[model samples]
Target: MPAMRFFVFALSLAVTSPLLAEEAKPGSPPPERIVEQKIPPLTPPDHELDLLFAQLKKERNPQAARLIADRITSSLFYSGSATVDMLMGNARKATEEKRFGAALDFLDQITLLAPGYAEGWNARASLHYQMGNFPKAMADTAHVLKLEPRHLGALSGLAAVLSQSGRDQQALAALEAYLDRYPADRDAQKRAIDLMIKLDGQRT
Candidate 1:
C-alpha cells in the first residue's frame, strides 16, 4: 500500500510539472519568432513555342529552324524580371552594332543580377565566339545548356566551337547529344555525317 501511494504521487507530479513552467524574468527579452519563406512555382513556357520546335525538328529546314529557334530564344529570355529583359535588349543592340565590349558589359550585368537566367550566358557566348574566344564561348554555352537543356542554340554553339577547335570526336559527341534531344535536326544530321567520315578516315 505505501509503495502504491508513492507511485501515484510521482505520476501526479510528473504530469503537473509541465503545466507549471517558470515565468520569464521581468528584465528578460521576449522569445524570437521564426519565419518561413515560401517559394513560388516556375511558370510554363508558351505552348506555341513547343509546337514550333516539334515542327522545326521534323522539317529540318533552315528557315523553319531559324523561326522556331528565334521563338525558343524569345521564350528563354523571360527571367520574370523587367530589368533583366531591358538589359538583354541592350546587349543585343550592342552586339548588332559590333560593340562587343559594350555588349559583354550588358550581358555581365544581366548574369550578375539574374544568375539563373540562361540567356545572359548564351548572349555572352555569342560575343565570345565573335571575338574568337572559343574557350570562353564553350564555357558559357555549357552553362546555358545546364540552365536550359532544351536550348538548341546553345547545343549548336557548343558543336560549332568543338569543331572549330579540331576536336572532331568532341564535336560529334555534342551534335549527337543535340540529336538525342532533337533527332530530326537536319543540320546536326549533316554535320554528324561529315564528322563520321572525318573520324573514320583518321582511324585507318
Candidate 2:
C-alpha cells in the first residue's frame, strides 16, 4: 500500500513538472513583461492619425467625424512632408462628410504649417462657403487667387459663394475671371454663361 501511495505521488509530480518548469524559467519573460516589451508608442501622422481616420471612416455622425479629423490634422502637422497628403486627405474627408468646422481646423493647420500651399486656402474657402460664411469664404478665396492666380477651384468657389449670398454681379466677375484663365474648362464656361443669364435677369 505504501509503495502504491509513493508511486501515485511520483506520477502526480511528473504530470505537473512541465508547468512548474515553465513558471520557474528565468529566460522566459512573464506575460506582462512580454506585453510591455512588444507595445509601441503612439506617434503623429501614423498611429494617432490612423486611428482617427478609421474612426472618421466608420462614424456616420458629423460631429464625431469632425472631432476625429481635427485631432488627426492637428497631430499630423508636426510630421512635415509625410503629413501633407495625410492632412489634405483628412480635410477632404471632413469636407465630404460636411463637417465644415473640422475642415476649417485642418485648413488652418495647413496654412500655418505650409503657408504657401494654395490648396490649403482654397479648401478653407470652400469650407466657409459650405458653412454659409460667405464673407470669410470670399476673403480666403481671394487670398488663394493672390497666391495662385490661375487656381480654378478658388475662382469657382468664390463665384459660387458670391452668387449664393446675392452678390450676383461679383459672382459674374469671378466666373469671367475663371473663364479667362481656364478658357478650355467647359464646365467653367457653362457656369459663366449661367451666371451671366442670372445676373441679367436680376438686373431686369
How far is each candidate from the true structure, as Cα RMSD in Å? 20.1, 26.4
> What does candidate 2's lDDT look like per residue over 64-119, in tens digits?
65566566446533433546657878999988998878877888987787666666
Angstrom error at residue 189, model 1: 1.5
Candidate 1 displacement at residue 86 in angstroms: 1.4
Off by over 4 Å in 2: 1-80, 202-204
Worst window of 10 by summed lDDT in candidate 1: 9-18
Candidate 1 pairs with clashing backbones: none
Quick one: best TM-score, which candidate?
A: 1
Candidate 2 similarity to native, TM-score: 0.56
Q: Estimate each model's TM-score.
A: 0.69, 0.56
How many Å off is the CA of 192 in candidate 2?
2.1
Each model's lDDT: 0.72, 0.63
Error of 2 at 164 (Å): 0.9
Candidate 2 displacement at residue 68 in angstroms: 35
| Count of clashes in candidate 1 | 0
